[model samples]
Target: MGAITIQELTKSYGETNVLKGIDLAIDDGEFLILVGPSGCGKSTLMNCIAGLEDITSGELFIGDDNVTSVNPKDRDIAMVFQSYALYPTMTVERNIRFGLEMRKYPKDEIESTVKDVAKLLQIEHLLDRKPSQLSGGQRQRVAMGRALARSPRVFLFDEPLSNLDAKLRVEMRTEIKKLHKRLGTTIVYVTHDQVEAMTLADRIAVMKDGIVQQFGTPYEIYNDPANRFVADFMGSPAMNFVECIVFEGNLIVESGNQRHEVVIPNTQAVIDSGLETVILGLRPEMITEPKPHAESGYITQMQLGVQVTEPTGPDTLAFGEWNGQEIQARLSPEVGAQAEIDGEVQIQVDTGKAVLFHPQTGARI
Candidate 1:
């Protein structure tokens, strides 16, 4: 069984707390990603799980056994590091077989494991070459191959794709996904790239400031974030936040002489809270070129003064201002061109899918 359960996990260095009360669980064969910006203690938590770092207070269970005090080697887990950590002098074949040999496995079993891992990673032809002779992606594969040869209960990937180039990163990302599906092994991956977290994780634990801000499926974390930070951090272009004044059960957005009132689902709740100001959260894709007609009261049609347009192949990003804050709207190429030329364009905002946050606390209202 590869299921992992972490209860009240806390890691501290002197008076500084790195991981503050982290509690998460993953079933057997589940792929979980720990993601956050640099210095958020994601890597530290990974080290704790790998037994490289000791936890201050917590209980960690892998399958049925509590492995909190177990040595890393005895934990029955394999790790793939960001640096590849390959022995440069040894050939790929030796590197893959090193772990099995260190465990004193039979010669036939070692050879078979090396062959199987090399074949699975599609690096059989390159197995005779040293680490210095391989490309970045190949080196990463050899690193993964080394970890795979162990066939441990859980696989730990610590920013394994960070060293690869853009195109290679995407390629390796797909390969890792395929590998996970094929092996059906539990994987705990750590990365700061939310795109990687979203693409690769079965469930993601978004960490920040030594704490897990939210833990859920990619869809839940993206669409229904617990707080404003999660919403702002997860998206590429990011969620657009505009400070608006709540008036008469409506949120008001103003630009120059024009005014737009957006009706949100929780307008009454926000009004009842006696909060006069709220931050309106809208994804870039939610604001687009004006449709033929407004579907409901939640959809507001307004004129947006596009200051800049960025062409991103299929669609263009139109930048405008609303409520004294910059806003990005994803529009079709033709619409973007028109907005660029005309300076102002009609846009529709689907507030039905929009969210509201407390202006002071940045908490979902």
Candidate 2:
């Protein structure tokens, strides 16, 4: 009954539109992440769902009720902010019991809820401490405890881990995931961190320029992007885009004075598009050192003039140029140790995982 449904939701500020035609749904107990860069309307969309911002158009349903026009408190949603909005003077236990007390709940029931939430979040030991006395991670746990005490229909997290340090953020991320599974609560989380979205979400909605660029599972969004923007934005080092010319059912890539032909997937689709020039999208890991059994129909062996090499512990990143565009390849540490800078190395390109996009429009071909 905690499921949410949004239909063509739109929000604006006078003449400026923030969220445009957003349609999304999440089943009860699902963890949904709204992820994108700043000013992409993710936060605005979250606000609209929470009843904090009025929508210009569209319908929003939580469970079976149309709560688009309902007040924030009446919507049965709990929100956790990035800033950890905890009361300065109140003890952690008092903070968690505040909302229930305001609603005139039985004193014993409020005490039990607070104790249970504290135990679930592992903040039982810190219950008597004030917010100022706790670390960033502990304060965040308190904030989460406060939200859990309400046990609302939906939980909204607006960049909850943004203030924590890197190590603490990872720990908190795992904690949040565990909490979601244990409580079986419908969660809507917002983050600009793609890694966070990938790790924490059951489904992700990538937004940009006031519109949802793509919405899918992490694997689909990472491997099968809707457009060039989604492909470039999701990955860590980002996907490499090389300009190539389509001719005779192959993509022609040029590096220096050499020309290499790469087999294209969906030959008929590329032919039907009738676009001579296209952008080749390849993830860094797709381009790697040649293997003994790597001889395959879709594999193309090309010589790359290595310009720079970066060793990042487990894997090394090699930078080279393809068709005058700089591209990166992930190499094994052993192979990278022998890679000479400013020298040429043979690389195996996997066309099986390659994606084609229209050059001018940036549309997937």
What's the lDDT for all of these models?
0.89, 0.87
Candidate 1 per-residue lDDT over residues 18-42, each given as its tens digit: 8999999888999999888889998
lDDT of 2 by residue, 1-365 (tens): 88999999999999998888999988989999988878888778888999988999999999999998999999889998767689999999999999989888899999788888787677899989999999887898889888878878999998877767888678778878888888899999998787899999899888888888898999999999999999998988899999988897678887779899889668888878888888999999999999789767789888888888889999988888998999898889877766754366788888888898999888888
Measured on C-alpha atoms, candidate 2 has an lDDT of: 0.87
For residue 262, what is the lDDT in candidate 2?
A: 87
Point out where model 1 deviates above 4 Å.
Answer: 104-109, 119-122
Work out candidate 1's RMSD over C-alphas: 1.8
> How does each model score on TM-score?
0.94, 0.93
What's the lDDT for residue 276 in model 1?
A: 86
Q: In candidate 1, which residue pairs clash?
A: none
